[model samples]
Target: NLRFNKVVICTDADVDGYQIRTLVLTMLYRLTPTLINKGYVYIAESPLYEINTKNKTYFAYTEPEKTDILRRIDGEKYTIQRSKGLGENDPEMMWLTTMSPESRRLIKVLPTDAERTAEVFDLLLGDNLQGRKDHIAEHGAEYLDDLDVS
Candidate 1:
């Protein structure tokens, strides 16, 4: 009997955070897929940027969202900064943006397309080196911005 009905995975909005999320999700899918299949697993969406004006602070989880926020606040003087990691965030901001059930955003991990999900996971993380190489060769350009060349 599990004590919690929902299991939420929270991480930063960066490359390392993405890797960590992938590894943990892969582990969970491999070890206890029931959690995912039962709709109990979720990923907490963290903001990538925090936009602050004189009176309001807005958190944007994606680049498009940041752009939208900026456009909405046009003509207003504001400072936009990359959001710090979970540990580095102040307690109030952390709670408001991530921990609060009312305000937080969550993506439910569903295996609705089980075969495709499995194939992609195997191609990227399994022992299919050639397949992984081929995939990157074919689709790498779509994710070039995500690569951390720095």
Candidate 2:
């Protein structure tokens, strides 16, 4: 048996990536919840933007960070592009942005209350179809702006 310290979930910084991450977490929460309870699960945050300058490259994970990066550059010529998925990124970029412990940002998966966590999982992913619908009906309005209707 192979021993491991942490189970990191790394995906693209996009909608599809968020869906995949949720599914993986649901599987883990259902099959081996101990990993989460014991603090062995983590989510590796991927950068949303890649800002390339004449001499350097900066990875920004959030809009504010990207703004800050641009502010720092202060009129310096730079090209900003949306970061690609992990599968598309080069080995060096992946290593620098994700695999390297020093540079990577890991959000620990800590479920403080097992009961509440289980309820949420069951309501959303379990066989409770009605519950999921009801939740969407109640909370979906808050996320309407996030929808990609186009």
Candidate 3:
């Protein structure tokens, strides 16, 4: 853990991407709370789609951005490419959008509600099978299948 001063979690901008993130956070929160308390843990924001309009290139992080851009511009003239994950992005694209300090966004990990965060993490990642099942049921069907572990 001392090899690097900080840990920036880089994941896909997809459901499964966050699942992996949660698993890692669980480990960090439990085993290395110091990393989080000291603001050494971070989450990198990777845009979900890169939109190439006739005039300019745009990156959309959420559906609303894409919708807004489409409405503002002629949707027919732009190309939207879904980002599968970090692996699919070219090295330059990756550096510009995610790794670079000038344009990239990183959310530092800091638990505002430590008790609640710990409780929820335990409920989701703990050995409580019934709790996990109930939590899954409460979230609905896609919570189980929509995660992009691949």
Candidate 4:
């Protein structure tokens, strides 16, 4: 019995992250679509913001960007907040990072390819463990990253 008024999925910005988010969205769409129709589910954009200044904040999209930001902000005192995962944060942080409309980025849930999406959800989150394992084994290698291991 899911009583959530809004389901905010804050996953990483990688392939696995995308797959997980898709699976959850699919389950909700199948089981309780009213919530989705009412604009309840959201995909929270986990920040890649590294160098935050008083004037403007920057999000590092890649290692090169991170290096560039560091170089640009050299000798300037700025707060660096390294957010590893959403689980490391508390409810307040979650609200601030993912829930707040003013400060957070949320993507509306929309069904693109319903049939393929249904099959994906079934393979990923269904009762069959072997199906889940095989699915991951086949597609997971593409998204495997060292930073995503946590």
Against the true structure, whose lDDT is highest?
Answer: 2
Candidate 1 off by > 4 Å: 113-118
| Candidates in order: C-alpha RMSD to true structure | 1.8, 2.2, 3.4, 5.4
Model 1 poorest ten-residue lDDT run: 111-120
* Model 3: per-residue Cα lDDT at residue 132: 90
Q: Candidate 2, 27: how far from true, in Å?
A: 1.1
| Stretches of candidate 2 exceeding 4 Å from the true structure | 113-118
Candidate 4 per-residue lDDT, tens place, 28-92, comes to: 77887766777777788875555678876666645677788989988877777665566666887
TM-score rank order = 1, 2, 3, 4
CA error at residue 108 for candidate 4, angstroms: 0.3
TM per candidate: 0.90, 0.88, 0.79, 0.54
Model 3 residue 96 distance off true place after TM-score fit, in angstroms? 1.3
Looking at model 2, the pairs that clash are: none
Please provide, for model 3 over 87-142, each residue's C-alpha lDDT reduced to its tens digit, 9 standing for 90 to 100: 98899999989999899988878865333567787998789999899988887676
Per-residue alpha-carbon lDDT of candidate 1 for residues 1-150, written as tens digits (9 for 90 to 100): 668989999999988897788777877887888888898989999999999999999999998999999999999999999999998999999899999999999999996633355567788978989999999999999998767677
Sliding window of 10 residues with minimal summed lDDT for model 3 = 111-120
lDDT values of the candidates?
A: 0.88, 0.88, 0.82, 0.72
Per-residue lDDT tens digits of candidate 2, residues 1-150? Answer: 329999999988999998787778877887888888888989999999999999999999999999999999988999999999999999999999999999999989877543355677678878989889999999989998899989
* Candidate 3 deviant stretches above 4 angstroms: 1-5, 113-118, 137-150
